[model samples]
Target: MAQDVLESPLVLLDEVRAGLQGGTMVPYLGPGISALREQEAPMAPEALADFFASKTTLPKRARGNPWAAAQYIESYRFRDTVTLWMQEAFAAPVPPSPFHLWLAGLSLPLIVDTWYAGEMRAALAGQSDWAEVQGITRAGIGEDRWFRFYDEEGTSIDADQAAKARTLLYTPHGCIVPEANFLISDADYVEVLTEIDIQTPIPEEVRQRRTGMSFVFLGCHFHDQLLRTYARQVMKRSSDHHYIVVDPETLTRNERRFLDEQGIIAIDMPLAEAIERLLT
Candidate 1:
């Protein structure tokens, strides 16, 4: 770990804007984006349904607070049914939020995130300019196709269009398409932490687009040990750019010191609000 050599914390957003003006900007997303849009409370995903169910099971005395009870029940237990009920409940074509729109306006050639490919693809497709730029993810082949890491191994090669898609969205957790393959279980997470290197280019492809862009990490928890491995790779591979991370909660002393050591720019603020501030 090396010192960050930070100029100032408050000016991170301005620094990002200036950095982007120099070249394309990459937006790397995390779970917080989905959680926020879903209006999930600050609780673990598995606990939600049970918590709500318990509340709804309350006696008549608690019926006056039916909204809270209903919310708990709906949020907690819906996972089992989301696959079948989400479309009717929330609709599939829901447009991206203002923050997402702003992100697409950057016109970056690459959009890499750890979130589900569907939401981010929807966001990018919603943008006029970005719509022309096909999305390549580990998800599907429509607008966003998976990176097809298997492509690297010489199994599934990319067609001319896929190889040249304006935007390549790679998610380590896998994608929705080709079945629910995104990494979630403990074993899957361990595999991601141990395998997969995004820094190096696959055979025949120009070494994973390294230059001409800055990475803006949003809603990342940095808790995954593998994430640190990725960070280390980026830090070691490049010396010409900076990486920005946004989290509304202020960083802890240890975390700050670690980031400072690594030269990572950590912004203290919620993702949506921070993007708003930067755009303005």
Candidate 2:
């Protein structure tokens, strides 16, 4: 990642400022953020998910759909096996990147990310006070339990005990928490979809943070409806306050429609450039 491009002089800084000063900006991060590490480590959950799906038989129609492919494989009673794979892959400690560090340093009101490796807390370390909420899944003999991971200390705490106190790092998707266990399959997604609906009883704290907030989606890919559906967990489907950064060439029609219908705006730019603007 070119930290230089991520410096100031961003074309979108004015727009980002509008969201910030208005008290509506919430940063939504994703797997591509970790890939930004480039040379340090490879903690991309998409790749991990791909590795699991590759070992099993994915339905023909689900060729490019990882979650769907996993669901197809789960139908064969191998979900637990897949969970184990996730556990081992996500258990290691992967350091947060400069982008993560800068974001955490800001101590923004709300930060939402889908990087299930639990790296945000570490990224926010020593910068400001922080709380983390991760949706974790544990598999039993024949069942899976979906629960939230909210520990005051979060994966770690850093030097500046004072500034480090007030940030909230959230992972809306299921994490491996212990290893090889996560929310995978059509059934798991159904639960997530329901959990984010209007009637679902989400935590008062989470609800409070998400309500009345505008969003800046960075390094995210809403390629699947399930993912777009998942976004509802953060903001309403009809919300126009949310904005996603994208590489225009890769943005498909369905992707644009899903975002548009939900009132989410798309900004065409590479992730690094977008992140830089937001930071500025």
TM-score of each: 0.59, 0.77
TM-score of candidate 1 against the unseen true structure? 0.59
Off by over 4 Å in 1: 1-10, 40-95, 127-160, 177-179, 189-207, 231-236, 245-254
Question: For residues 108-142, what per-residue lDDT tens digits would candidate 2 score against the true structure?
Answer: 87778776665676776666456665554433435
Q: Report the C-alpha displacement of residue 236, candidate 1, in angstroms.
A: 5.7
What's the true lDDT of residue 139 in model 1? 16
Model 1, 164-279: lDDT tens digits are 64445454444443233333333333334443365322221223444445567776656435456554553344344555555424555555555655556666556667666767
Score candidate 2 by lDDT.
0.61
Question: Positional deviation of 35 in candidate 2, in angstroms?
Answer: 2.1
Clashes of 1: 16
Quote the lDDT for 71 in model 1: 33
